[model samples]
Target: MTESQPHLLFSFGTLLDRQVQTALFGRTVATTPAALAGYATRPLAITDEAVIATSGQDVHLTLERRLGSTVEGAVLRLTDEELAAADAYEVADYARRQVLLTSGETAWAYLDANPLRSAARIVIVGDSIAYGRCDPQGGWTGHLAAAHIAANETQNRVFNLAVPGSTLADVSAQTPALLPPRHPDTLIVAAGINDSAVPLAAPGDGHDGLAHLTGHLDSLAATARRHNARLVVVGPVWLDETRTGDYEGLRFTTDRALALRTALRAWCADHHIDFLDLWEPLRDQPHLLVDGLHPDAAGHKELHRHLDALG
Candidate 1:
């Protein structure tokens, strides 16, 4: 039999119940017994009583992080559209985050980003784009900081440590210093354009040693996990020039950003990390960029919207 192409979902609640499943989805689904490590279940009384039967009980099951504890559940295969429906069904009380299964694979599970309004910080790291090298100046990082603070999240801290002209290697090197002992809620990473300059990479088959690019990114993901931060990788955006600024003996073709973006999507998917495709979002929108390099004020505003939508 051919294997189904479906995203993995770890369900510990009513979404798994046979009756409830049929009521919402109009059919039953195949599910394998699964358990989530580092989590436990809590019963939350629904505000509206009409949801009792559909939710599988008077109180719905919610997940809580508890090291060494495992939440027994089922792993179901779902298509992209079904997953979106599931998301809509799971409204306000829950937020989805990647969960590592006992089988050494990763899947999406609803977990709060900022539970109970406690202190949460987000670290922004990247290149000139993130550093706000635009005509008007104030970048998306500043906009995001304001949004987070305005939401009144407890002890909200948005640290923008992106440096201009930095590559993936540079960000990886400085990341450790910028991280605090408490860890961060999110780590926004935007890079690759500068690294594509070729001369910045090691000696290899003319492609600036592209072999190690993925490895560098993987290492950075590990770093983010170590700090208990959710990794949000932003792919390279479109460039106006035919080629990147010359770096010694090398000048990367501007169109190559699209190829990097395509590879990045797969990379992020495999690593179960959040990725923002800046290239496509700003592809047809030329006015958003200043000199076809940095984002204008309106562009930064749009960037802020995309990151917010990432939630």
Candidate 2:
């Protein structure tokens, strides 16, 4: 017989019930005994009628963080499609996250969902584009912050620490704000455009520029891991060279932007972090760029829509 694909899931609740398993997966799944350390189980009231009917229970066990505690469970190997079914079976009261088991295995487990209950702080650091220079609505970050406030999630904080014309090094300097008691739950970086801008009279290829930006990104990723925060890298936007060419001592070209965007995408993939690519999406829409550089209000709105979709 062929072995199941490697989508390990650790379950300690209704998923263990034979009937529930059959109802959800159309068959009883084989499971190996396992235990999740550093967590305890608590009752989570389920109000979803469909979920309650499928699980045949109104209350289910949910995982909660507690030092020195462990929740006994079983590991079930599932295919990607089966995993999606499991996700569908889970209620909104739970959020899935990867965890290390006492058996020296890593698996996905559902825990109590708390983003709505506990306000999450998001910190954005970048340059003029991230700072909403040309947009009256304060760019995409500003739109995100405003939406949170308008939704009555007052405790949910969004900090935009972008500086106009800042490069990767300058943004790296701004990461100090992510330390200690004010550590953000998420960090969003919207940079690279400024770094891609080369002096019109500069010599040699821009290989050094790519390396420098990527190195800073590596450091930022390490910092996010240390703080147990999620890191998202936003790629550079397309520039209209007709209006921006040689305006200053520096030159902004589409080729440089494409190179940086590709680099950012690859780095994010290798590091298993989130990346938002804005090049192709905004390239054809020259009207979005107010001054052939910064995005206008409508463009900012478009950016916000994409970012929000990431969730």
Candidate 3:
């Protein structure tokens, strides 16, 4: 047999976009609303409205039956090129794994893993989420390491370079210098929340919002490209309703965030960079926040759901 033209990807989040599905997976994808065992989902309050997951060390959600409750998704029939494209978007933060589907079938899905390779180092740049704070087991980074080992059945090294209370400028200032040494295969940059939270004065009085935002992004992107590695930019999550109007904590500067999101999306498109806009996915969920800034266990689970769908 020539081969059954590899056709399937179990997705869970924004990669579930119809347009993206068609573009990367050849024709329309075949999807089954599926649940990943051992994980729970939630919304994030910090950066681009995104979801997170909280899965314990040994707990797995038992699928007694194929629950019909579906989260919108499609499983695509993909080619190596298509798979490569999808990998560019996902593999940085996750490793592809074989998953048991609702129908008792199996499909290749991207499972979270430590972003590391003996030959290729992975450097994650973002905020507290990247730092794996609030999560005693080391947040997603720790989860990422476990997932990677489970999927690859091999060891891969990664560094959690996320600095708490640091802004995009701070990361930008630091990343380029380290690239020569780390030589990462993937550079994940999660910006916006902090930037929006701490806005710089209007640029010398003449720059527009778009210009200001893009200017900063341009610098980040240029640095990423110079490193010759894949750059994944995670937009900030939405602000909590309770803290929306207040600038004290976790509340986003709505105006600044919108500007940053638009500009970054455009930048991703123009530069062929991978962008995951998480804000819209978790906007409706008000209870995801554990505090004004971080997401609860439930909130983190949902974020992983979104990442799974990124394929």
Candidate 1: lDDT of 209? 30
Residue 29 miss distance in model 1 (angstroms) = 18
lDDT of candidate 1 over 1-311, digit per residue (tens): 97658888889888898776677667788999888765667776666554664665667778754445688989878877778777766746676767668876677787653332222467789998888777354587788778777776565677778888888888888787778753565678887777766664554556553445687788788777655556778888766663235545655556556667776788887765666777655666768877666778888888777766755
Q: Mind sharing the TM-score for model 3?
A: 0.54
The models' CA-based lDDT, in order, is 0.71, 0.76, 0.57
Better of 1 and 2 by lDDT: 2
Q: Please name the candidate that would achieve the greatest lDDT relative to the true structure.
A: 2
Candidate 1, overall lDDT? 0.71
Give the range where candidate 1 is weakest over 10 consecutive residues by summed lDDT. Answer: 111-120
Off by over 4 Å in 2: 1-119, 205-207, 309-311
What are the RMSDs of all candidates, in order? Answer: 6.9, 6.6, 14.9
Candidate 3 residue spans exceeding 4 A from truth? 1-120, 153-155, 198-211, 244-251
Q: Kindly list the per-residue Cα lDDT of model 3 for residues 1-311, writing each as its tens digit.
A: 57547746767654566665555555555555654432222231222121112111122111111112333344656777777777765523455544445455555565443223211345787777667667776665666656544654433445668887767777777888877676554677875566665433432445333455566667776676565445677777665645555434334555667777877788777765567777765676778765545666666667756665554
**Residue-by-residue lDDT tens digits, candidate 2, 53-125:** 9988898988654445678889988787778888899987776655667876767787655422222567788
